[model samples]
Target: MTGRRALRAVQAASGLGGLVALGAASQVWLRVAVPRDRPLPDAALALSGRTVAPLVTALAVAGLAGLVGLFATRGWGRVVLGGLLAIIGAALIAAAVPHAWAPGPAAVDDLLTRPLAGRDPTRAAVATTVPGWPLLAAGGGAVLVAAGLATVARGRRWPGMSSRFEVAGQRAGPPRAAPDGPPADAAVWDALDRGDDPTL
Candidate 1:
């Protein structure tokens, strides 16, 4: 692949990976903190689950779009990526605010105890005893938001092989040889030129 295409691939992969990580974290939080076994108050559970599912799905879809977009070099791909990042960032901020302002001790206790049902609660209890848990939670959320923002920024610069080819073609450089010897496989070169994997 050309340098630009490589860069775009890296950006897409990183964004996708970050989004997946964020989604997984959110899933873990939901599974742990939210009462799963007991039926939730209809409105609370439905609203909560609804809010989270979309954000996670959006992020995952955005990542996938980014990957496809990189290859297709379509404006729509960037739009999808940008939109997903924006939604994910907004969700993180919205979720974090409540956690940030929550009663520190109670919130911490709930988070800690909710996860472990029958395990030794002493160590967990001690850990939750610390102050500033809300702040910590908010900070963690902010970090995820920042990561989402970074992914969005990277998406905006989606690179492609065509641009690289134009630049390289313009530069004054030494004549290059056909790697496979004289009368090279023009088809292979053409495929590579268009950002296809020659090995495939």
Candidate 2:
């Protein structure tokens, strides 16, 4: 297609990718909590490891901000934003890949005694099997990275906010008051009066 149209297409793809990334991240966080029995025999269970919520949350927010910058910032600013976006995407992919395929025991492994691995583990103590959500997150991250790279390459040519979007300029000095009769005239002088104490 045309050059501008291509640029817009890239922009649109990037936005879509960012949204997917956010959704996938949320899914990972909400559905994938690893269960680990507390170190103490009687303490409450503690969860940790293989959890991507914080990273995902951070990337998701970054994705949104980068999207805004795509339209709000220009030149170097846009380029910098694009670079950051790419980094976030790369992080997502890196974070999720292992979980999807080779997910470690996460917190569950740490808490359980060697026997826990073998015993028809108690429902309360067992962690959920690594789900496919991580794969989705990784896919989303990949899209974000690709789009971000495109943005970095052609962001200068991409469209941005209109000139009208800028704040209105302020006048150099305070506005001149509307003409009132004659300045310093008798009528204007409340205390000091005119020769006749001019009728108000």
Candidate 3:
């Protein structure tokens, strides 16, 4: 109804959408890039096992919190939701930057047929100097950050429609005095017969 209410609605929708996108991306990355069969670099494996999974779980929780906050009209709830979104975005960026900027051994060696008999090469030696994965991850992270920011902004003016309704009621005021005649409505006519000016 009012601008604030409309904004809250928009923010809620954006936050939910962003959260869903982030979750989907994380799941896809894990399935394709961190599959069980693949021998992840030590660092990559460690991060995926110790850092990324927890972060994803946290982000999902935050998304749910944001949705609840939107409905509850609680200020602190919205803030927490926004903060969660930020955390998720930051985690994505952190994970993506290394992958994008520094090519790992997996980037160069053919995973399908690479021999395991020889000494494993360092990520620096086998890393590809491309900006593909990083750019995609960064872009997605930026969207999430933006979504979080939007949620916080919208929270500032939430429940605006309630205020509008109150103001409208106030403006309508008490009924005006009717002209010296029975009012048109049958209800008013009954009041008039009872020596009461229903308009007043």
Candidate 4:
């Protein structure tokens, strides 16, 4: 593909990746069972990806907002933003991969303990990971990294916003004479006055 098309693709991919990460963050990543004393049933709780890794959501938001930066900036400015986007993607991957493999105690402690504050503190809760969501989040991060890398490598050659406006002006050719009341000579004079090539 041309550099312009490639840059557009990168923009699309980056936006999609951010959306995927946001969706993944809202999904359930873990299920924990809160045990109580005898004769009481264990309380089951669901922990979302946001609870497991807050950084995932934060990074996703930043990545989405960076799309505008990619479009508005150019040259070294774009390169710097691309590098920053890559770093955000890498951080998201690091934050989510661990939860995809296994649940960490520190990961669940904060959100899990909030609801069980008044209950039995000695009871052990079994935390089961639903890896689907975390895996999805990691995949999103991978996409963001790819988009950012592509931007850093080839963004300088892509057409800028001014180029698009110039292209539009060229495609417009010359203005046409009004069909109604202005005589042909009058129209020619108007074109000449405006420095437009009337013959064309």
Candidate 5:
């Protein structure tokens, strides 16, 4: 694809990646058990998940910024930015693995042992598994990385925002109508070019 199209695709992918990461960070990531089976389960935030939510959010924000910058940048700048995006994707992959970082049955035991005032620890099943947000985030990161690669490959040929939005080149409507006169008389500048002056 053309550089301009590649850049557009990258922008779209990066935005999508940011949105996905935001969802994971803002929502519950896990559910822990209680003393006995209860009507509701204990939910855990992304901050308390296997991977830190802030890190994921930060990567996502960077990815989004990269899209904005991609439109403005070319040459090696795009390559460097793309490499950063790749690193973010790698970090996401790493974060999703190595389940040891996640809290296991102990988290449930604590809640069952002592619930806060006005709260009761209902009998819930022990939760030894982590939620799915990390995986989702990782998938988004992967897509973002692909977009970054596209930028690196073809960004130099892409047009800058300023060039596309230039006032001299931009048109908001149909072409302007010519003056109601003969061609030689209508465009005095053209007539002057042919050794004739309209005023003289």
Candidate 6:
């Protein structure tokens, strides 16, 4: 594809990936239930991806912000940002992969136990892996990696912010006259006052 089209595609993919990760992080990755005696209600704990892997959420947000930076930057600046995005993507993948595969009891307990310490001194919460959200988060990370790689490879040629504003600013400045003549005033009244023919 052409540079501009490729840039647009990469940006769109990056945005999609960021949104997917954010959505996944916000959703429940695990459901924990504490088994109790007949008198107590089983405490239902919904552990979101953010709680399990905070890095995923943080990196996803960085990726989204980098997407905006891509439009504003070009050349080496864009390459640097792309590299940062790639790092963020890789971190997200690392954070989500383990949880996606097998969120073991210990891992779950270590994260959930502290909060339940005061509520239930003897917490035997069984955590069921939701799996879907983590998988989606990993998928998003993969997409972000692809986008970052593409940007680093080809973003130097992609169009930067429009130069129309710069051109407009130049145009708005005081008009210059031809080197061969005095500055020509376009006002008819000025020509008449100068005892010159307005028609000419």
Task: State the C-alpha lDDT per candidate.
Answer: 0.43, 0.60, 0.50, 0.81, 0.61, 0.80
lDDT of 3 by residue, 1-200 (tens): 77566655556654564455455444323211222222543222212211323444454445555555555554666656666666766665665555445434454343223334333343223332334434554565666676667666665555533433343236445755556875579877887685554776
For candidate 3, what is the TM-score?
A: 0.43
What RMSD value applies to candidate 4?
6.3
Candidate 6, 1-200: lDDT as tens digits: 88889889989999999999999999988788765555667878888888888998998998899889888999999988888888888889888888765466577668864554334446566778888898899888888898888888888989888655345345455654434545356665786675544554
- Candidate 5 lDDT over residue span 67-137, tens digit each: 77776776788778877777776675565443324455555454344343323444433544445676777
Better of 4 and 5 by TM-score: 4
Give the total clashing residue pairs for model 5: 4
Candidate 1 backbone collisions, by pair:
none
Q: Residues 1-200, candidate 4, lDDT per residue (tens digit)?
A: 99778878989988988889989999998898777765677788888888878899999998898788888888888888888888888888898888876555555565575665345558667789889888889888888898888888987777667643443347555746546654599777997786665565
Candidate 3 local distance difference test against the native = 0.50
The residue ranges of model 2 lying beyond 4 angstroms of the native Cα positions read 2-4, 28-52, 109-131, 166-200
Which portions of model 3 miss their true places by more than 4 Å?
A: 1-69, 104-130, 160-200
Better of 3 and 4 by lDDT: 4
Stronger candidate by lDDT (2 vs 6): 6
Off by over 4 Å in 5: 34-52, 97-102, 105-130, 163-200
Counted clashes in each candidate structure: 0, 0, 1, 0, 4, 0
Per-residue lDDT tens digits for candidate 2, residues 39-118, read 52422332222244457656756776776677677777877877888898898777666655433454544444344322
